[model samples]
Target: MHRSLCLAALLSLAASSALASGFPVTVRSCDRDVTFEAAPKRAVSQDINLTEMMLALDLTGQMAGYSGISGWYKMDDELKARLGDLPELAPQQPTKEVLLGADADFLFAGWNYGMKVGGEVTPDTLEPFGIKVYALTESCIHIMKKDKSSMEDMYTDIVNLGRIFGVEEKALALVDGYKAEIAKAIAAVPADAPVPKVFVYDSGEDKPFTAGRYAMPTALIEAAGGKNIMDDVETSWTTVGWEGVIERNPDVVVIVDYGDVTAEQKADFMRKNPAFKDIPAVKNNRFVVLPYAQATPGPRNVEAVKTLAGAFHPTVN
Candidate 1:
C-alpha cells in the first residue's frame, strides 16, 4: 500500500507538469491569462483579418463562428457555406451577450481596439464566462502606444499564429514562398533608378482620406519600391487638401478598392475632383486599386506588396 501511494503521487506530479506545459503564454496586448481549455474545438473569430489567418492556417474546420461577410475581403464560397450554421457576431463591436451566447470555447480577434476603446468585450470580461481570447500581433500595435510598426512584426504574427494552431511547418512553407517571390521582385529593380512617389487614397470619399506615416499602407509603399508622398504626415489617417495632392504630383495613386466601389468609379471620382485633375498619375492613368484586405497590415500584406511591385515595375517580368 505504501508503494502504491508513492506511485500515485509521482503520476499526479507528472500530470501537473504536462498541464503546465500546455498552458497558453500571455501575449503582448492583453493582461489576462489566455490558457486554452483543450485546443479550442469550437472557436469564433471576431474580425475578418483573424478569420483570414485561420483560413490560411487551414484551421477553418475548428471555426464555430465568424463576424463580417459579403464585404471587400469576403471568405471563399466554400467557407461562407460552412458559416451559415455558425452564429453571426457583429464585426465592428459585438455585444457581450452576443459573444457569450455563441458558446465558443475560444475567441480570436485581430485587434483590441473594438474591445478596449469601445468598452465592449474584453479579456477580463470573457474569462469569467469560460472563454479564452487571443489578439493578433498586427492589431496589438494599436493598443500598445508604439510609435512605429514593422514588416518583420507582420512576419512574426504569421509564425506566431502558425505555432498556436499547430501549423508551424505550413506557415514556414508559406513564408519561404513569399520571401522567394519578394527577393526575385526586389532583384529586378535597379538600385540607381528613382523610386516612384505614391499616394495611397484609402476610403472616405467626403474628405479624400490619405495614408499617413504610421499606417500600414505607408509600410507597403516603401516595401514595394515606391515613396509615400505623405510620409511626413505623423497620423495614421489624414485629410489632405486637393491642392496638396496636385502639388505633390505622385507617379502612382493607390486607391483602396472596396466591394461597393469599382476601380473606374474611384478613378472618375478623382478625375472629377478639381484639385486632382492635373496630377501626373490621374492624367497619365497610372492608378492601382488595392483591395481592403491587402491594404491592412495582416497575413495578406505580403501579397499586397507583390501586387504593388508588379504595378510599379511592370517590365520586371
Candidate 2:
C-alpha cells in the first residue's frame, strides 16, 4: 500500500511538471504565427476589453501596466476595484514608444487598438524586442480571414490566453461560466416569439453608423431575441444613410454608448430628428443602451446580451 501511494504521488508530480514545461505555445494572429516561450511575467494590455480580460482571468499580477480607454465609462465595481491599482501607461491609445517602454514581455491588444495603420509599432516591429503580441480574435479577421465574428471567437481568445499563461484550467472554467450564462440568456426567449427588428446606433448622425455582421453586437442582438436590421452589412462597423435606417424601421434601437456623446444624447438626437421621428423605435422610445466595451468582444459580452434581451423581450420576466 505504501508503494502504491508513492507511485500515485510520483504520477501527480510528473503531471504537474509536464504542465509547467508545456511552453512554446503558438497561436495564429493576423495571418502570422506568434509563439511564446513561457508564461509572460510582465504583460501590457491595451483597450478596456483586453485589460478587463486579464483581470477576469485573475492575471492582474502578471500585468506590468495598461494603456487604453479604461476610464471611458463606468465598469463593474469588482472590475474597477481589481484594476484600481495597476499603473497607467497611457490614458488612451499609446504609441509604440510608450508600449515598448513599459518593458513588458507580452502585449494584449486587438487590431487598430494597439497596432494602428502606418504606426511605429506592430507585431513585426516588436518581434525583435522578444515581445509577443496577440491580436484579439475578433479584430484579427480584419487583417486575415473572413470568419464572421461571434462569441466563439471570444471563447477561443480566452482559451488561447489561458494556454499562453499556463492557466488552462482557469481559462476553461471562465469559458464554461460564460457559456452557461449565454445559454441561460438564450433559453429565456420563447421559440414562438417573433424576433424583434433591431437597429444599432454606434455614432454619426448624417451617416448613422451601425454594427455589421462582423461585430459582436450583431451576435448579442441575435441572442437577445432580436435581429439586427443591418446584419446584411459584411463589414464590422459601417455607415448607412438615414434613408436606409428609415426604410427598415427597427422595433428597437440599441445605442452603443461610448466616445464623447452619452447614450442619452444619441437617443435624444434620434428623437429630435425630423427624419427619424417617424421610425418605429424613435416613435415608441424603445431605446436600449449598451456600453462600447460590451459591444466589443470581451468578458462583459454576457452582460451585454442579458441587458439587450431584457429590452427586446420585456415580457420574459
Candidate 3:
C-alpha cells in the first residue's frame, strides 16, 4: 500500500511539472509573432468563415462560443447542427464584455471581419484582458504587406490553428485533402477552352463593390479557369465605378449572396440598369450567385472551386 501510494504521488508530481512547463507555441499573426505558452482553454471566433475554420478542426470543445454570425447572415442548418449546444455569444462583433463574460482566452478573427483597424476590440485592447488574437492570414494585408490571397493563406491559418490547439495531424490531413481535390478539379478543365472573364459583384448599385486581385475570390476565379476583371484594383474588396464593369464587359458576373440585398435583386438591378445594358454579361444573362460562406476564404473555398469550375467550364463534367 505504501509503495503504490508513493508511485501515484510521483506520477502526479510529474504531471504537475509538465503542466507547469506548458506547450510553448509561437505563430506569426500578421507581421507580429504571437506566442502561447499553452493551448487556449476557451476561444471565440468571429464571422461564419473563421468560425467554419475552427469547426473544420473539430475545436468546438476548445471554444467558449462564436460571435458575428446570425446578425449578418443566417446560420445554416449544417453549421447549427455542428455547433449543437455551442452558444452564440454575440450576433455581431463581440465586445470585450462578451469575451470576458465567457472567459475566452483567445480570439480567432481578422481585420474588418471582426476587429477593425484600430477599433475598440483589437489585439491591443484584448491583450489587457488576457485574450490572445490570431489574425486571419488573408486579412494580414489590412495591416501589413502580403502577396495576393491564395489557397496557401487559408492553409497557413489551418496549420497554425492546429499548432495552437495541438491538432497538427488533423490540420495537415485537411490541407492535403484540399490540395488533392483542388488539383483534380483544376486538371479536369479543358486546356483548349478560353478562360472566362469573371466579375465579382459583392454589393452596391452606384459604384459596384467587387473582389480585387488580392481577394480570395480572385484566387478562386483563377483556379476555376477564370480571370477577375478587377484584378488590377490593388486591394482585396473595393469599390469601382460601373463604367469599369461596362468597359471590361466580362463574360460572367458572380454575385456574392449575403446581407439585406438578395442576389436576385442585385442581378435584377444590373439587368435592368441602362448603364449595364451593353455589358456582355448583362446581354448574355450569365450571372452566377455564390454564397457568402463559399465566396470568402475558408474550407468552403475548395467546394467553391469545384462550383466555379463547373460554371466557368460548362463543357467539363
Best prediction by TM-score: 3
Each prediction's number of clashing residue pairs: 0, 0, 0
The CA lDDT at 316 in model 1 is 62
The C-alpha TM-scores of every prediction are 0.82, 0.90, 0.93
Candidate that would win on lDDT? 3
Give the TM-score (vs. native) of candidate 3: 0.93
| Residue-wise C-alpha lDDT for candidate 1, range 183-248, written one tens digit per residue | 776777667656889988875566678887767788788877898888887655568876677778
lDDT string for model 3 (88-186, tens) is 999999988999999999999998888888788999999998999999988888888899878898999999999898787899999999999999999
Ranking by TM-score: 3, 2, 1
lDDT of 2 by residue, 1-317 (tens): 69999999998897777656786678777677778777898899888888878887888888888887645553456766778788878777777677678887888887767776456767777788877889887776567666776788889888888988888789999999999998998898888888889999999877888888788888888877889998888777778887888899899999988887889999999999898888889899999998877988889999998998888888775
Error of 2 at 22 (Å): 2.2
Error of 3 at 188 (Å): 0.5
Error of 1 at 34 (Å): 4.6
